[model samples]
Structures are given as structure tokens and as C-alpha cells.
Target: MGEFELIRHYFAAAPCAQGGVGVALGIGDDCALLDLPAGEQLAISTDTLVAGVHFPAVCDPLLLGQRALAVAVSDLAAMGATAIGFTLALTLPQVGAQWLAGFADGLGRMAARCAISLIGGDTTRGPLSITVTVFGRVPTGQALRRSGAQPGDLLCVGGFLGNAAGALPLVLGEREAAADVAGPLLEHYWSPVPQLQLGERLRGLATAALDISDGLLADCGHIAKASGVALQVNLAQVPVSAPLQAFLGREAALHAALTGGDDYVLAFTVPESALTTLAREVHVIGRVLEGQGVTLRDPQGQDITPVQRGYQHFRETP
Candidate 1:
């Protein structure tokens, strides 16, 4: 099939195109249409994943499909937006039916789970890369942002950290791990669960919120910088999974949780008064302080921000 045909058959016609909640119209048109409730605003985010730089040069097409969409949608979750639809721009070295089939299947699975629809996009010839733009809806002026934090607010995280980072060695083929340890790690890396529900629940409760794509400390820095408040993170309170500790040991796991990126968990600031109102499980890591920048302190209160902040795209050698 030709380019347009390929997109139509494998993408626009996929299960994700079945018309989701906020999609007014999807695919087969000059532009897909989205609608927001009278008092709601639209949330949008874009992300790109390049082969070798983002993922292994040769990786499972299925997992890549899932990862690409999930990564983009995580932004919406950060804003406490309800997922609506997405557009995909795919670049392939060459067309292969098997690869496309697997990718479409994976994308469909994630779309169905998130209740998002595929809208419109493009496909082209080039090195392997995928760009996804996602849309979501949130009540006007109620969407979570990084600039609303206040002093004395409790800092919290949606779930465990460092599992995706712990999987990097196995993913790069530099190290080997047993199934019990590796399986969960790889799943965390490939299929990160976007905390959309939790983000929605936190809309009015969280003073400031963001999805932790970079390491927790690094992403927290973004919030601190945006909000103009100092954040003190308790190293002992950062959540790490038991499986990650078993595979990499507590020290390594701690390091991973501190500096390793791509966890995709949600981090937010909750007022001391609103803490009891949160219905979701979250680890209270620290509190917002009146100052500037992000500070990491061990149980004994020693400063230990990593010498390296986190992943810097062009700055860090791929």
C-alpha cells in the first residue's frame, strides 16, 4: 500500500480511531475535531522518540508503540486532564507489514485502555522515529500546573520510582537479570501507566503538579523553578520498588531513584490541609519550603543533589 493507504489501514482505522469521549470527529478528514465542555480547556502535549537515542535501535515494535503514546499522554495527566484523542506522525526507514501490524496492535491496546481516540497524522520515509501529539480536556482554570506550589505544602509522588531506570542495563544488553527482577523492570520501562485518574482526582487538591518524566529530583526542579519556591525532598522518603532493590541493591536503587530518568510517575504539591482528602495512594516525600531551587537531603540532613541533574537532550551524548 502507499503512504496514505498505510496510515489509513494501520493507524487511522485502528481501534483507537473508534471515536472516544471528547472527540467530535476523528480521522479521514482534513483535521480531526475535538470539543470541550463550556467551562473546560484543552490540554495538548507533543513528544518524539528516535531510534537508538530514545530506544534501542532494534526493539519490539509493540512496546515502542505503547511507550510513544503513553509518554505523550503523561503530559495531559500532569495537568489533570481527561484524555481525548491523539495524532501520530511516524517515520520509518522502510515499510514492513509485520512491524506496522504489531505497532498498531500495541497502540490500539493503550488507546482502548486510556479511552482515547486516534485523530489525524502523517507517515513518511526516514530514520525510525515517532512523534505523538495528544489532547485532553480540563475544567477552565482548574488544570494542574507547576506554578501553583506554596510553602508548607506536602510533596508527594503517585507511585514507585526507579524501576524504569533499573531496566536500562538489561535493555541496553549490558547486564543480565533473572525473569522475576527483569520482567517488572522492563514492563515499567516499556509500558508506564500514565496517572490520569490520580491526576484528575488531584485537580483542586494539588497546588502544583507535574508528571515525573525525568528523575524525581530533576522534574521537581522544574516545578520549583516554575513555582519560585524551594522544595526539600527527603531521600529516605523517595519510594523504590522491592523488585528494583532486589536486582540492583538498595544503594543502586537509591541512586536510580535519584538520577535515573523515565519513571513517568506524577509528583505534586498538596496543602497540609488537603492531605487527608486525597483518595489515591501517594508517598509523601517532603514539603515545599520558602526559598529557591530543589534540595535533596538524606535522613541525617546532608545535601546530595547529584552532580548531574538529569537527561539533557543535546547536551548529554546519546
Candidate 2:
């Protein structure tokens, strides 16, 4: 079959997730038609994963498919946007049918799960990198941003601090663990699920929002810097997974949770009055104080030193 046919059969149209909107034209058309629903403003984001850079080399194609899309879609989640559709730009050294099949399967599965569609994309020859530009829509002027946080709003995290950081030891062959632990760590590294539903729910509730891609402390610093307020995180309140605790020990675990990247969880802020209204698993880790730094607090709320900073573009090590 031709390239266009392959895309049409495998990667073109995906069923809507929440039935929020209908696609006027999905695939096999000169251009796609989308109806921007009333009261919603379109939110757009793009991300690229390079080979042996953002992800490990020789990983599962399916998992790679999942991770690539998840990371791109995460921007929408951070902004409290309901995912709509995405375009992909895939580069390959060679288009092996088996590889394309696996990649398409993985991408299709994720699109279905997220209720998104593959509106359009391009493919070419290269060293196997993927770029995804995803779009979602939320009510006008209500989508979350990094600058909305205030001095008195409470800071919270959606889930555990760092698993992707703790899992890297196994990914790089630098450390070993029991099979049970290894499996989960690798899973965390391979497949990161975007928190679309929770982010949508946080729209009006959260004063500001951003996802934890670049470590908790660093990402918090992002909110702090953007919102022009000092943000303090309490070490005692930071959540770490059991596998991370067993693998890295308490202090190192906290470091990974603080400086380690790729947790993909939502770290957002809401007024103190909304604290009790939070869902079952969400944790209120700190409060937005009148300051301009991302520091940690001891149990008594005194400042503690942070060991590592946020992710850097050129740094070889974190």
C-alpha cells in the first residue's frame, strides 16, 4: 500500500474520548474540519523526543509510542484542557513494516485511551525521533497557567514525587533490583499517563497549575518564578513510592523526588479554603508564602537546603 493509505488505515482517525466535540473531517481530506465549541478556547502544545536523549534507546516501540504522545499531551493537561487531536512527525532510519505496525498500534491505543485523533502528520528518513503537536480546548480565559498562583494559595501535588528518576538506574544499567521492582520502575520510565481528567477538574479550583516534568522542586520554582511569589515545599510532606524508598533509601529518594525529572504528575495550587475539598489521594505539600524562591521546609516549617536544581538543557547529569 502507499504511504497515505497506510496512514489512513492505521494512524489517521481516532475515536473521540469524551464525545466533547465531533470531527468534521478526520482523514482522507484536503484539510480537516473542526468545530470549536462555544465557550472554549483552543489550547495547543508541541514536544519532541529524540533518540537516546529524552528516552532510552531500544525501548519497546509500543511503550515509546505511549510515552511520546503522553509527554506532548501533558501540556494540555497542565492547562486544564480537554485533549482534542494531535499531529505527528515521525522520522525513521528505515520503515520496517513490523516497526511501523507496532508503533501505530501503540499510538492508536493511546489516542483511543485519551479520546484524541491523529488529524495529520508527516514521515521521513532519519534516526527515529518523534514529534507530536497536540491540541485541546477549554473554556475561554479559564485555562490554567503558571502565572495565576498567589502568595497565600496552597501548593499540592497530584501523586508521588519521583518514580521516573528512581527508575533510571535500571534503565542505564547502573543499578540492579529484584524483578518485581524492576518491572514497575521500567514501566514508569516507559509509559507515563497524562492526567487529563484531574487537570480538567482543577480548572476553576486551582489558582495556578503546571505538571512535574522537571523534578518537584524545580517545577515548583517554575510556578514561583512565573507567579512572582516565593514557593516553599515541605520535605516531610513530599510523597515517594515504596519501590523508590526501597531502592534509593529515604534521603536519596527525596533528592530524586526533588531533582529527578519525568514524574508527569500535576503540581498545582488552590486557595487554603479549598483544601478539604480535594480528592482522596491528592496531598497538600506546602503553602505559597510571600517570597520568591523554591525552598524546602522542615517539619517546623524552617527552610532546608535543596540538593539539586531543575533540569538543564545541556547538563549531562542532574
Q: For residues 55-109, could you state the per-residue lDDT of candidate 1 as single tens digits?
A: 9989889999999989998999999999999999998998888889888888888
Candidate 1 error regions (>4 Å): 1-4, 305-318
Tell me the tens digit of each residue's lDDT in model 2 across 255-276: 7888889988999999988778
RMSD of each: 3.3, 3.6
Clashing pairs in 2: 17-115, 230-291, 230-292
In model 2, which regions exceed 4 Å deviation?
A: 1-9, 13-20, 306-318
How high a TM-score does candidate 2 get?
0.90
Query: Against the hidden true structure, what lDDT does model 1 obtain?
Result: 0.87
Candidate 1 least-lDDT 10 residues: 309-318
**Which pairs clash in model 1?**
none
lDDT of each: 0.87, 0.80
